[model samples]
Target: QQQKCKQYMSAELKIPTPHSDCKTACILLGQSLKSDLMCQFENHIADFMDGLIEESMILEAAPVSAVFSSSLSDKERGKLRHLHPHSQGKQFISRRSLLDELFEVNHIRTIYHMFIAALILFILSTFVVDFIDEGRLVLDFDLLVYAFGQLPLVVCTWMCMFLSVLLVPYNLFHLWCQSQSSSHGKSRLCSWLFGSVYLIYQTLGLGFLPTYVVVTNSFPPASCFIIILEQVRLMMKTHSFIRENVPRVLTWKKDKNPAPVVPQLSQYLYFLFAPTLIYRDKYPRNPVIRWSYVATKLLQVLGCLFYTYYVFVRLCIPQFRSNSLHLFDLRAMVLCVFNSILPGVLVLLLGFFAFLHCWLNAFAEMLRFADRMFYKDWWNSTSYANYYRTWNVVVHDWLFYYVYRDFLWMSQKHFRTVALLCVFTLSAVVHEYILAVCFGFFYPVLFCLFMCFGLMFNFIVHDQRKGPIWNIFMWTSIFLGQGVIICLYSQEWYARHYCPQKESSFLDFLKPRSWSCQRPLMADS
Candidate 1:
């Protein structure tokens, strides 16, 4: 029986084929099996091995196959399907948030409790300090009030943006679809009509309007951030809606099919409020809303807000607000950056926990959206590449699908490195825009870090660097990056308020004001 099985296996491999994939699989399977058991179950084993090879064998190229792969055309190479499991891109599943699952563990819960205790201590220390200084405990939220000023305008601006996004994209697409049934010339006219309107809406309506309002109003950091962040989110959503749907429209036109029914108005509206940037006719949803979970997450968000305020007031204010340090002096700047590291790291943690984890999860729960992976365990990332991917997975998904993959598809799967660089630049620019608008300056520190260090680390310190030392390296880089950002931005903020440029130039706007301001040019607030 063993001899017969061997002959059958040999015959199977000897069959003419385009490639040796199945032959290799068959050989490996025969060698891996127990020799003693193979004699008794030789026929069965042979059959099983043959079936496995048929199912699993695929044409995949590796380093060794580069010589052969080089001869394939760009079109052919782009069409080459990867059957390997690891090659598959993101597959989102309905699951609990990483933090939600982690908190169930006693060890993680204790760490959470420790943070709560620290918050309590901060509150007590503030009360005691205020009482000692003023002979009464001060409870006024002057800082919070100033930071969140012009709340009404922010709400109004967001409404206009959201309403425009909701109406403009969907209705314009509907118009375009209706036009498809008309004469070719008429269809072209309608396409031009709605297409131009959509472009104007995207450019003037979503892009310039919110930014103009924020800058014109001289909005405080918090208020400016709200408008800017919402603007970016809506723009991304609008793009995703169009990008994901336009292909279907084109396909219908190409196939000469009846115009497909447009996306339901309800679906578009739900997507506007949904946590995800990707548009779909439907999404995985929970059977019921967990109101308790929603409430808990929202409360955590509030806690983080207060936590940040305290950090800025206690650590940042006392240090940067001092009358002593020169804003631009080398020694002073170096000291400021190093000293700011602790608070910078704290604020970083707060921002991640507040927005990405608590805020997004809260909205997801309220909406019954079940794909709860807003972020992964980015803190455990040993490489910056893993850190970037794991950090804020929601945004990464949008960039990956719309920006990265679309670039590949457009470029015919060539210039992968170029595509990566473009993606990095766009991300950096958007981030810099956020900070530049919110803080009202053009420092470019974050942009430099992203483009230089970030792009380099993405290539160098990839997923393979899993040593404990790499984790330390990752943390150190983040800490220093955050410290420089906060220190430089804080200096610029104070400099702008203190040293109001009596008159400004294009150069002044382009240059960082913190570099020249040595002392207050205006009186204290």
Candidate 2:
């Protein structure tokens, strides 16, 4: 633990003097307690100096940052500017995730308990239904099995993506930074050469390769979705790393350091596993791993998975497996949509809890990645803009910092609305792509919702909306939107399979099969 603190202090504080560095590391690690190392050092000073110790060696009563820079060695002060660079004054402060802190409150923990209780009810209801239908309780996971089919292919494709991302971007940056010491023409030539290669890899290697494997291999929805999601995640991480670090490298190059300082391989490796899209040499981390906390979060994720399965079995399947599945009436479509709201809302909540809350917190705990603010109180958001900002802060931070901020910086901050639109468009496209691959069909319900209604809401309901009514409106919109998503996707999923295309055409793949196809979907027995 002391070693970890020293490492963190070295990378994060960048303190030069051994005395200040060790003292600060100890203070941070032990938090408000006098450090054992400091005590030992003091004792050594007393023995070595024969009770006549020097004043310069002792840690001051003032703040570490104040005394810290005064003790900077000349070599460190000179070389420091060229290393890892980011926004000044911003530093990773070790902190708990919102949910973890919230769970300390009785009311907040009760809400969590409510979700667990719902899971219990779902399990009991599934058993009851099975007992009534089969004359004995039946345990089955046919849907789960089918969804997560083709696991081997998914694993292989993921490894390929991970390896390519792990190697390509960091190596490119390292090589490019090293080449900065060469002649101007040589550096410029190498820049284009390395930049082109990196772009090609990002597009083809990270983007297309895994997608091709997923598409051609006929992986199931769960398998395909995970592979694609991972591909995007890696791509985003690499982008953020490069965007954040490239300027730092250039700044270091300008300093004419004989050896350019790039990020360590260890830092890059940590970023890959850390539950954050942003890249930094170090993050605020915990002193020790809580295995029990990790276990609880993972178990909750598993429970949420089963809860979703039963939701599909009890609510979604029975409704979507319609008697009038062959009908193409507006009335049927409306009923399908309205009937989907409850199940769709449940799925949305379960997904948020499972992935954003449980899964992320589990990984964060294991990694001791202390900045756990993966999301916020999006449920309480009164405005669509606030909701969007708080929904998935991990993603939002990437879009805001890299996409939105960069766009504004490029455009001189005049096109704020345009930047916002760009974020929405990119998010919508990626979302639509995920759904399309998973369900094995092209449906733009979410895309339309994001681009049209979502964007409109963002403008109409700005941060000025603080009333309770606005909150009501936001939730009502969410409920309706969830209904549309589930209903359309469910219908299109069955339609694509039940009414498979005869001969391929451009319109055939683009068009919605549910609108015209006349096959009735059979409910699972």
What clash count goes with each model? Answer: 0, 0
lDDT of 1 by residue, 95-124 (tens): 778898889999999999998888888888
TM-scores, all candidates, are 0.83, 0.82
Segments of candidate 1 deviating more than 4 angstroms: 1-92, 258-261, 323-327, 504-506, 520-525
The candidate that achieves the highest TM-score relative to the unseen native structure: 1
Q: Would you list the clashing residue pairs of candidate 2?
A: none
- Candidate 2 structure quality by residue, lDDT tens digits, 1-525: 456546544554433356666667765656423345654566676677852322222223213222111233344333333333333322344555667778999999999898778878888988998899899989979999999998887787788788888888999999898888889899999989999999999899888888888878888888888998998899999998888888887887788766656899889999999999989888878889999989999988888888899999989887867544554778887888889999999999999989998999899989999878787778888989888878897898788778777787899978878887899999999999888776767889999999999999988998878899999999999999999999888888887777788786767767898887786675642
lDDT of 1 at 132: 98
Off by over 4 Å in 2: 1-91, 504-506, 523-525
Alpha-carbon error at 355 in model 1, in Å? 0.9
